[model samples]
Target: MPSFTRRSLVALLAAGSLGLAACSGTPSATPATPAATASDGALKVGIAQIVNHPSLNDLRDGFKEGMAAAGYVEGSDVVYEERNAAGDQTTLTAIASSYATKDLVVAIATPTAQAMIQALPDTPIFFAGVTDPVGAQLVLSLEDPGGNVTGTSDFPPVADQLALIKEILPEAKTIGLLYSSAETNSHIHADLVKEAAPALGLSVQEATVSNSSEVAQAAESLADVDAFFIGTDNTFVSAIESVVQVAEARQIPLVVSDPDSVARGALAAYAVDYRAQGVQTGTMAAAMLTSGGKAGDIPVERAKDLELSVNPGAAQRMGVTLPQAVLDRAEHTIG
Candidate 1:
C-alpha cells in the first residue's frame, strides 16, 4: 500500500475532528490535581457508551485497567456509572445528560462523544478509539485540543489497507465500500479510499446503511464489486456476522479497519487494537486525574502498534488461500 501524503492525512484528521465537533463547548485549563478529592478516595466517573458490543467491551475493560494502574480501585477510590445507548441517539443524549454530575465523563464512539460534547461542555470528557477527533469537531487540533475533550484515536492508516487489498486480490479492480451514511468515521475512510484507490488502478463503489437493520441490503448491493473494504462503521460493525455472510456468499474478499472484525469473518484486516486505543485514552485520563494535566491541554494520541489479522475460515469459505508471506506478517490469525 502507498503512504498517505502529509496533506491528505491532515485533511482526514481535520474532517474526523470537525465531525466530532458537532457537539462542542468551551475549553478549560488543565487541572492542578486529580479531579476527585484525595481524602474521600472516590472519583465519580461516568461512561456513556453508544452501543453494547465486543469492541466497546474491550474499551471498557482497558479503561478499567488503566484506571487501576493509576491507583483507582473499583470499590474504594472510584465510583463508575455506565450507560449503553444501543445505538439510539436519543438514549445516547439521555445517558450523557445523566452523567452531568460526575467528576468526569468518558464517551465511547462518535455518537456518544457528540452527545457528551453537547450535553456537558463544562464537565471534562475523554474520548477513545475515535477516528477523526478534529474532523468530528470534538476538538480544535490534536496538539492543542482547543476544547475540554481529548483522548486516543483509533484512526488507522487506511492507505496501507488499500495497498494490502490489492496485494491479496491482484485481479480486483472494483472495491466496494460499505459503511453507515450517518457516521463521520465512515466518511473519513471513504475520503481516504477515494484519494488512494485511483493510484492502485482500483475504483470504489459505495453502499451506505444508516443502521444495522439495513446492513445486509447495503452489502448485497455491492455484489458486482470485486471485493469489500470495511470501515470503522458502527452500524456495519454491530452487524458483523451479517456483513460477512453477504460478502462470503458472493465470494468477495473482505478487508476491515479493525483486526477483531477479521476474527469474526473478514478475510484480512489491517488495523490497530481497539483495546490498546482505549488504554491510551485511559492513560491520558488517568494522567489528567492524577497528574494535574488538563483534558484540553493535552493532544490526542494515535495508536502506536498496528496489527494484521487473518481468518483462515473466511479465506477457506471464500475459496481464497492467503500466501505465507501475508500470513507470516499477520500479528494474529483466527480460523
Candidate 2:
C-alpha cells in the first residue's frame, strides 16, 4: 500500500495532480474523497477600508465570519488581504488599486468602495456602509446593479431621524442639517431629512461643508439651531471631534445618523450596525460565487435593523434632555 500523507493529499487536490478517496491508515474503511476540480486552495479576498475604527473593524470581522459560514475557512479555503487608508482618499485609491488583482474586493465605506470601483473595473466588488450606491455611480440602479459592484447600505431611516428629532425637541421649530456636500450619502440623507422635516412641523437649515477643515465652522454656523442633525458624511465623521468641540462649546445638541458618531462625541444617533452589513455582503458574495451568479444580479441591500443610541453625557453637556420615553426605547445609552 502507498504511504499517504495529509500534505501530499492536499497538494494533489490543490494542483489537480491526483485524486484520492482518503489517506490510507488504520481507520474507517470508507474515507472522504476529494471532489475532482474542487476549489483549489483558499479563495483570495481583498478588503479595503478608508480608515480603521471600531465600526469598520466590525464589518471586517463580520465578513470573516460570514465567509466561514459559507464554507470558506481562513487558511484552508480563504485568504483575506486587508488594507487601510487611514482616512485618506489618495491612500484608499492606492490600496484599492493594489488589490485589483485579488479574486474579490470588499470595500468598507463609501470612499473605499468608490476607489475600488474606479480602480478595479472588472474585479468583483462588494461594498458595505454605502448610503446611495446609484448616486455614487457604483451601480446603475439598485434593481439590476448593471456592474461588478454590489453590497449593503447603512442609510438611516431618514423619516425616523426626523421623527426622533420632533419627539426629542418638540419646540425645535428649525433644525440644522450639517453634512459634507461631496458625500453622496450625506446629500441623500440631507434630502430625505428635508423632505421628512416639513411633515413633522419642522424646517431644515442646510449647512454644507466641503471638507473636514470646514466642519467646525459648519457646526458653529448651525449653533443657533434647536437641534443639529449630522448626516453620514465621511468627511464629517472624520472631523467629528471638531464638530463636537464646537457643539460642546456652544451648548448645541447633535443628532447623528451613525452610532459610532455618538460614541465618538455626538449627543445621540440612530444607526445600523455596519458589521452586520459586512456579513450580508459576504453572504451575497458567497451566493454569487457558489452559484456563478453575476454580482450585478444582486441588487444593493439596506440595513435590516436600526439601533438607537443616546449619549447622556454629551446631552447634558449640550443641555439636551432626552425624555424617558426615548431613553427607555434606545438600544444603548452612555453617560
Per-model TM-score, in order, reads 0.88, 0.83
lDDT of 2 by residue, 176-208 (tens): 888776555666677778878888898888788
lDDT of 1 at 334: 94
Q: Return the top candidate by lDDT.
A: 1
Shift in Å, residue 163, candidate 2:
1.1
lDDT of each: 0.77, 0.74
Q: 19-45, model 1: which lDDT tens digit per residue?
A: 321211112211212343344657888
Candidate 2's TM-score reads 0.83
Worst lDDT run of 10 residues, candidate 1, spans: 21-30
Taking every candidate in turn, the Cα RMSD to the unseen true structure, in Å, is: 6.6, 16.3
